[model samples]
Target: MAHRLLLRRFVSVTLRGSSGPVRSRSSALFPSRSSLSWHGTGPPLHHQAVPATARGFCVSHASRVTFNVQNQADFAERVINSKKPVLVDFHAEWCAPCRILGPRLEKMVAKQQGKVIMAKVDIDEHTDLAIEYKVSVVPTVIAVKAGEVVAKFVGVKTEDDLEVFIKKLTCT
Candidate 1:
């Protein structure tokens, strides 16, 4: 019991920097991998859209697995109920378009960290949530602000599109 409590405390503290304090969760229920799960050790502030700088750019999460948000309900709570902006990518492993868009999205993640909670959802695994959002296509990206869907796209989107929308988005 004490170990569980300590673990929860550590996870909560570390997670708060990006996703916020960890709430109740079964150990196995939590995903071991997530690009967004890193705290201040968070991904650098360089845009994948920009030229690789010595300090800002190292490598993208291209070869590594994309974010795994399976079964973790509280995870999205920080996103949907955010004090900033929330962006979600609904994708499938089988879609070639999703594959092409994956690196683009990951690049955005590196740049948008403190400003936005960049999240990804594997529609193949989390069907119900996808249905709720009415995401009918792979690589559907949605931006949420103040717990409401503010911007949406049904196919692959460019970083410029996201940047322009974000420039117009309000975060107060």
Candidate 2:
């Protein structure tokens, strides 16, 4: 119990230091004020009873699969020349939208395994690469083919948009 609280504090502090705004875990884990089960790091957060006053935060229970890239060289080698079109998401751990978009992307990749590959770059950590790609946001998803970027979307994007972009990327 104590460990959970401490971990939650650590997460909150870490998120505050990152680019995106931190969301209330209570609001994230719970939806309405009427919860079936109750748990707490700081306070009891019910899944169904999260009041609108809980906060303007939303957490979608989705799967977001990501590949962590170490540096520009590795990214180039792994994504640029890959047979499958690579979708790189430039994000930071703290970003809210990045968190929301993460799981959705995982499901998307799973559904379109042969046609697309999804990767992530921590812009905060990989500053140089993010700058090279001209990524000015927390969640910039880029579609690359034949070592060149074919499509780019800054901020949250739909899976359908990614699918269409991948289909359009030139295989050079």
Per-model clash counts, in order, read: 0, 11
In the range 113-136, model 2's lDDT, one tens digit per residue, is 456777888988899989898998
Deviating ranges (above 4 Å) for candidate 2: 1-66, 166-172
Q: For every model shown, what is its TM-score relative to the native structure?
A: 0.56, 0.56
Those runs of model 1 whose alpha carbons end farther than 4 Å from true positions after fitting are 1-67, 170-172
RMSD of each: 17.0, 13.5
Among all windows of ten consecutive residues in candidate 2, which has the lowest summed lDDT? 47-56
lDDT of 1: 0.64
lDDT of 1 by residue, 34-55 (tens): 4355355543343112221222
The TM-score that candidate 1 achieves is 0.56
By summed lDDT, which 10 consecutive residues of candidate 1 come out lowest?
47-56
